[model samples]
Target: MTNGIRVSVVAPVYNAGPFLHAFVNSFLIQTLPGDSIELIAVNDGSTDDSAAILDDFAREHQNVHVIHQENSGWPGKPRNVGLAAARGDYVFFADPDDEFGGPEALERLADFADEHASDVVVPKMVPRGDRLYAQWRYETTQIDADLVTCFTTLTPQKLFRREFLLDQDIRFPEEKVRLEDGQFLSLAYLKASRVSILNGYDFYVIIHHPQQDHLSAKPVDPANYIGSVAVMAENVEKYCTDPDTGDRIINEIYFRKVLANFTNSRVATHSLERRQAWQRQQKWFIDRFITTSRFEKMDEIAQVRTDLARDGDLDAIVAYARAGSVDFTFVSARSKRGNIELAGKLSGGFSDGELPKLVVIDRNDKSRIVTIPIQLAKSQVTVQIPKETLPLMEGARRYDLWLSPGRGHQNRRIEGPDRPFSLHFTDDRDVELYSTKKGNLSIAVSRGMSTQARTKRKLKRIIGR
Candidate 1:
């Protein structure tokens, strides 16, 4: 047994032989001393060589612990086993397919946890070939500000204080279910006293290979997906006493899950049979958990989808899913005097007679959707250059521009090499641009960007060119 371990990294392995070596080797090569960190790997009945590979590591490494169990068809049971065996000040749960972004990831997490005495520390979850998680915008955030805001991300791939987890009796659902990560995370966030974030470095590299047979890669199983949501909703009602918080969580957060995860996918890609069945299941869920008041509180698009789903209108749902399509063209980016101006063209179709508008959103501000006027056209829509749209570019992050059909409708973000764009502000106090060695886009800031925007005069005064 290992002693004085700073962190216990619990990874659940299931037929992940191809990536197991790389995944386990990441912990062995950590900048955090091998003796100071323990890797508790539970092999959940893999028919592949994953068991043999883990056994070899257990023999070779002093801090490696391996447990083999009959396949449970999910990572939940295996992770729970690993959690029981973990012996560290803090615990980290990881998937067998994903690896640490860097050698020092554990060291960094340990340092941050120790310094802040935090219950949870979320490092940047850098997905394969994509931007980092937008939710992680600051170095640290206290959950007291908005208990649901900081920890809404349901992924269990985070550093948790061992004592805090035990004290709260927080564990993943044993039933092999979809979106289980979010269910456990929501509960953890609501109960957590303190939550901090550590960015500026990649802590986790999530690999998405087509050949991978993970749950997400498989076909949509409506029963399991809705089951997962039901479990999470039950916990929310049980734990949360604040009526207002409960209402907001159910409407704002969980309602989005019902659409984005359950309804949207079923409508967009699944077969007609599957779509109808999924709708039937979701309708039951909606009637019970999702109140009429909550449905009314949803955004415009969400309300439309929910109504269509309730009515079982498959054709209308499909049309609504494909209603708005935008092709945005980035013209140029220039800071004028104290204003950061970005010019782009909006070309696409809008439904509900909704006009095209330039929308700028910050990574931190989830509620603020700023709309800028655009010039509409027959074949393709156009928007004037960075004129009075300066306010759109003001954010903690270099704002991501979206050509939205209407104020509350869905937005299509313009990405890729063609008609590219970037933002640079003279004032490095709140947000600035910097190039990373890995070539990922991130705005450099001395401090966290203000969640609330400054008045027009205050913004101009601070952003002198």
Candidate 2:
């Protein structure tokens, strides 16, 4: 009863006329054997030439299959339909605007799944342009990865064992709903026995279309979005039996999706009525899932905002949305004895007695954080780090600096000057301070000869200094 198809790519196409050619071409050029792969393009009542383009591909290629359906408003119904029609061992849900990372993307994923007997396979997903995803989880190939740690990645753009999905009766919520991907993936993760993460190469390239807006890019109603999240929370409670694991999953969702909505600048633009409705919905979720102990473990800013929203303090919440954000400006750096002294200015809407803390986070290992108290005199701040404090024995280290405005206020990264600057410590350790692409201040520490010292040594050998 089984065909030879190893992978079936189910793509729900809407008004994707502009991107249809490149999208379909990405699949056609796959290095996976022609007979082992199929592309199922479900046209969801596209108004443009998308239907014609899909039909053309189907006629030209035997592996390309096209299904036409009425507009589903969202991708859920079309995705479900495409899933039902898939005839491969594994199913991959794809968006028409994005494409495979390279020619061998599907071939490698299918081979890895077969070797590991994986119920779910997640390949490295890299954004084409400036978009970012959490890269820490995909740092290495993992077999049977912990679902709790991998909960942040809930998108349906992963390889699912078609039999496992069918056995669990897992299907997308067939409605025009937000976070349907989260709901579907949450159930899959809970039911999956063996989940494998492949990090060797990029398998999926997420591209942003210049002329079109993705579904996630469209404006979201706060109430409706939170309602969808609540359904995901319900899934966690129902399927996840362990209370501790359930709390961790729910807490992560609350932090990433629920609390982030209020802390971001978008909430500032909401009308009074809209903000109130958002607060009401958020409070409902928090009361049900987010316990006090778990809430306290969140960032100070998140704790403050959630508290304000839960208490229905509209004025205070608005003030936070408008002005309580933080920022830092780096002025200079100097070598003091064997230590490094940093000077910066902190700016934010803090109350009269509030103070900001200098937070140093290790880029390699986030658990290693150093918090230093700063005395702000006329907005100027200074901090000195001893040579012993630098993780010099760890070969090379990069630490990002942030200004954490105590309690009730959000933190911000310190912005450095236009050009990178360096300072040499007396401990034979060289330090280069630079601004990251995102304009955040970071210092790289390395042992042995300093760059300046190396340049001097080279000059001495040439000129006999």
By TM-score, the best candidate is 2
* Each model's Cα RMSD: 9.2, 3.9
Q: Write the per-residue lDDT of candidate 1 for residues 1-465, one digit (tens) a residue.
A: 236889999999988999988898887889987788999999899999999999999999989999999998878888889999999998999988889999989888888777777788877777774324554444454433355555356778889998888999988888867887878887787687777767778898877756778686677577778777777777778877786677667765555566663334345667888878777877877887878666666677667667767898877666565545545665544556645444455544444265667675654665655677665555444544342333434333444456665533566665533323444344434434333344322233333334344455577888985
| Angstrom error at residue 364, model 1 | 16
Pairs that collide in candidate 2 are none
TM per model? 0.73, 0.86
The whole-model C-alpha lDDT of candidate 2 against the native structure comes to 0.82
Least accurate 10 contiguous residues by lDDT in model 2: 346-355
Q: Model 1: runs farther than 4 Å from truth?
A: 1-3, 130-132, 135-145, 261-268, 292-297, 326-401, 415-465
Alpha-carbon deviation at 8 in model 2, angstroms = 0.7
Per-residue CA lDDT of model 2 for 80-186, tens digit only, reads 99999999999999999898888999888889988899989888898876567777888989998767766888888899999999999999998778899988988
How far in Å is the alpha carbon of 107 misplaced in model 1?
3.5
Local distance difference test, each candidate: 0.70, 0.82
In terms of lDDT, model 1 sits at: 0.70
